[model samples]
Target: MDETAHALGASRTLWELVDRRAGLTPDRPVLLQGDRTLTFGELRDGAERVAAGLYGMGVRPGSVVAWQLPTRIGTVLLSFALARLGAVQSPVIPFYRDREVGFALRESRADFFAVPGTWRGHDHTAMAERLGARGVFEAYGALPDGDPAVLPPPPADGTAVRWIYWTSGTTSDPKGVLHTDRSLIAGGSCLAHALHLTADDVGSMAFPFAHIGGPDYAVMLLLYGFPAVLFEHFAMDTALPEYRRHGVTVAGGSTAFYSMFLTEQRKVPGQRLVPTLRLLAGGGAPKPPEIYHAVVREMGVQLTHGYGMTEVPMITMGAPDDTAENLATTEGRPPAGMEIRIVDAAGRPVPAGVDGEVRLRGEAVCQGYADPAQAAGVFDSDGFLVTGDVGHLRESGHLVLTGRMKDIIIRKGENISAKEIEDLLHQHPAVADAAVVGLPDQERGERVCAVIERRPGTGDLTLATMAAFLRGEGLSVHKLPEQLEVVDALPRNAALRKVLKYKLRELYG
Candidate 1:
């Protein structure tokens, strides 16, 4: 989960960071790619020019411009240009397939679309051509046709619509989350503070900028006049050198990638890698206690656990200094200017000990979901966003997320949780990535089916093997997966995390 991208150095708006840096570190590199660098001044100038071009295209105040691209100078500049126009910029990550992408385009009603011509393997130009958008600006190409820009029309938080983002869905239908111009400014501030990023802190983004994590985080660092190492693609081979070359002081990515790096026991031959990095952020999936313990012991960097979604945005983040247990067990407590509650089925707040739906209320929350009726169902009577996850509160007073209320499977008359099975499966040495879903059973209402990706080069993790592993650990016969599907790699999203269970269901079930 990421808030808006604002500066932490002082009380400054997102624009103020660009303004200050364009003056202080005008020659300092603001963005970096393979042998390509854009100084702060150049970035500012390019953005203004691009904003002028966008204005020529009639992208005015409140217009929704959806951008889909891998990280690049163009992506960053165009984002700034859109912000300059007071247009709510929505970034579409690469992880989304056409189904998800088409859903967001319709729900956002985006007037202008920005994308690159080509990426490492994906074709951005083909996607742009397929969409047939009204105001299409290929960020990757040259658009010499320009005009002087005009100031945006009178500011209004007045329901003109903002960024319509899609969160990981429970059902097949993806959740369209909305955020306003004002909301982005307000929310991004939380990230700036929590990370303690400074102008000297060069951030290397591992995730795509379109998602809440990358650009939003980078935008905040940019606002602080820090150099941002923009990776066109998330290549670990490339990421390590950039970390050392750019002197990136802070770096982070999703839990899956963090696990990939840590679990592999990566070694660098030279001096200390990424010596300046102070913060390492991991989220997007449940972070097992063992993963966090390993990261702390090995990386020797502050681990920040963030909990977020496109719908609820960044709800809770476990700060580095908060405590080791908080980082391991629960998502951090509610941030400032936010309220959280554990509610039962009747929409009533339950006692702290009992597990129920997690509800949140804050400026950072989405304006609403896509459909009005659906929005009514998602938002509570008192205007709290209903997070479908179920969990209990320890006496220690931190959020302990257990499982999604919607993903819970019913077996015979008993409700069986996939999270319980998945967590137990993760403790095994062979299991790398695991997902549990209910399979139809004529006898028992539903039977548990576990789909797992084994550690690289591992053999087939059939039902018999899983059963033996579970039995050796304990005799929990009922909780075992009736079926197991072992694959090479688990499907992930733009964040290089988030198992696309919906896609898996469509592909397998």
Candidate 2:
């Protein structure tokens, strides 16, 4: 690790780093939204006051507080206040309903629950009460406030598990992922170092602030003393003005975000999407290489994709200075202090360029799942967390992900990579987005099914045309998708905008 990163990693806790950054640049803006701006100095003072109020309300260190609020200035203040008070916070995505929200509150045993009143046409306060949540209170425009003198000293330890983040839970109930202050800081440091960001750069947060990326992105802002715009509701038409208004230099949430920007740019051929957008970078779902080449060619911006998950916020990231082939074909390289190991089925190390399960051991990795029994099977004997992802490392140290172990389609007892076919489908001119899944088949055991969202104004896409396109692209005959389904939009999760493959299987199977 570099000296700057090493220093950031040494911080005892998240609030401590906030204090350090605020001390250095008290007047600099840390967050921007429309006409509102929150400076470093205001963040410190406001959070301290809110902490005092919460303390007065009997919220102390180690208190379990669950908050489900939108991405707004008040939400950030509440989160920082919890950090200042050393409370264990579990952030629930605002879009979650009674089923997921009830599970999280019950699992975490939260003592206090914060809701957003009536937001986006949903009555969260009533829902919290309906779920029998304890200490349910609305925290929106007006947060609790009190005298700062009543607050206790901030936490000194950074290694304690103070965060509980839930997974998307596509197959089953969500798993609570345990995280610490140091781990989140380490994850953000990897992103900041790889992106080569500076104080002059402006960023945008289009995803939900309750997601893990909220803290991960905040750490970068604190370390580099730059500002990022917050979008409570992000859409292509609505969000473009905010990006241009702030002169955002770096923008993107994930693959869906890249496609959205490209679509807008196509409406006006010669015009740049965001005048100041020089780089489009993010990672959550898989990135088709075609998207990389198209963004560079049409949008005239560099696109760098990385690999990360709920367990590890950042594993690998593509650097801005890397070669074009590496940026498009590989999920950048891991930073210093992060170890990437590829192992065979028996847990033996595999040779470079050989496909195997990807495992990780690093400061950015989560401690473990909240359920001890479930955690035991996630890590190997050597302490590396089995990522459940199938990939290989290239000779250049870059990571090449094939697909998920469960996502591989079996046809005639032959395993085929769904991601491989999906990547090839993305290169088709008429195909806007694609997802591949395995469907039950008596003859082939499991057949390949392709679900695609067509580009606007495009004619109906047929299975034969898609098959011919894949064949022309040099795809293997056995790997071709036998079934095709077209739709106006692909189902996606609200947080990372990742396509929900299970939903597709349920709808088409």
Candidate 3:
């Protein structure tokens, strides 16, 4: 990063970062949505007005406000407005319904709630009323506004826990992940530095603003003084036009996003999907090596995948200058000050290249879970957050994730890696997506099961054929899936669309 950006990154709070960036380039655009554009000056002024209106609604410093709004310019304004007031804000995904939404509101003890009213044919206001959400109000079109003069000073401290982000709950209610402005800024700085982005680059936000990535990406734009096109709903058909219209150079959200672009590029192999696009970058779900090769070879863009979670938004990120071998096979190296410690079952440190639980210590790590009980046992004696993910550090400092600890399947007394099989399965011409899961078994404790979502115009993928393919790919005999089940589409959460493996286990097991 440059000295100016480095100085901006040091701002004490999110609102302070916004103010500094806005001061340098007040008229420059920071957010774009179709024909609408929100400049840096407007972002600062508009947020102050919104903060004043929120204050009129009895929202004071330390007040908890929960918003379940889509990815839009208005959402960003509301978020920063809350930051200006120093309010503790909890952002729930817009697509989340009664169960997830109610859980966040209750857990945060929100003094106010913001909804989108009836969005995508669902009445969120009615649902909030039914859930008995306090201080419910709609924030779809015009947000609450008042004079900026009435607004109090922006927050002075950035270390206070002011943001509550929920993890997508598949089996149980989501855990409230606590974060501060400095932690979020550090996470975004890691991502921005790794990507080597510049003010000339135009990015795109195709995911939900309620996601933890929202702030992560927002901080990038703030630090670099660039603009990103906002997509309330991302679909190839509708989103393509906006990318072209705004000249989006950096575009991606996760592995699924890369696959989507590759799928589109395949339709017209001779032409680029987005002529201005040069980089595909994201991190949330696992990225298969085959997918990386397909994107680089077919789509003609540098594909950089990273490893992150809601707890830590940017753990490690693949740089564009990384070797093809490393880019295709491993998640990129961590930035300075972000510690990666691999530990065994007994919580002992393991050497590089050994598979173990990934423990993290960094400025980007969250404070802990909202519930004290949920936060218990999350960190080790060394104060590193014990990520449930299983990965190994290469001697080159890159990260290679095998699979989640829960995804490991022990069949016939032999532990098997689901990602090992799934990564190989993705190379199959007939498979669009595959999930390897463990099913309960009386004799062996658990049996390996492969769920396949076949590619278009492909024939049936039988267990025998899948086994033959894995064998051809050099998978060991004991690791072969015992059963195969085909599905139209795998279950996924609204944000990031990460595969809901727990639901698959519940259905198949």
Q: What clash count goes with each model?
A: 4, 0, 0
TM-score of 2: 0.81
Colliding pairs, model 3: none
Ranking by TM-score: 3, 2, 1
| lDDT values, one for every candidate | 0.67, 0.87, 0.88
lDDT of 1 by residue, 1-509 (tens): 22223332232334545666677667888788878899988876787778788888888877888888777777778877776567876778764445456666776778877767666565766766686655666777564235444545333332344566655454434566777544554455556656656566777777677776654565565556667788877766768777888777777666655655553344742334467766777455566676677777777667777666655456677777788878877877666766778888888888877999888887767788666756777777898888788876666657788777677554432335576567778988889879988665433435678889899866666799888886665434555778788888878897868888777666665
lDDT of 2 by residue, 46-147 (tens): 999899989888899999999999999889989999999999999998877776689899999999999999998989999899999998889988899999
For model 2, what is the error of residue 165's alpha carbon versus the real structure, in angstroms, after optimal superposition?
A: 0.2
| Rank order (by lDDT, best first) | 3, 2, 1
User: Best candidate, lDDT-wise?
Assistant: 3
Comparing 2 with 3 on lDDT, the higher-scoring candidate is: 3
Per-candidate TM equals 0.74, 0.81, 0.82
Best by TM-score: 3
RMSD after CA superposition, every candidate: 11.1, 10.9, 10.8
With a 3 Å backbone cut-off (N, CA, C), the pairs that clash in candidate 2 are none
- Name the runs in model 2 displaced over 4 angstroms: 1-6, 406-509
Total backbone clashes of candidate 1, pairs 3 or more residues apart or in separate chains: 4
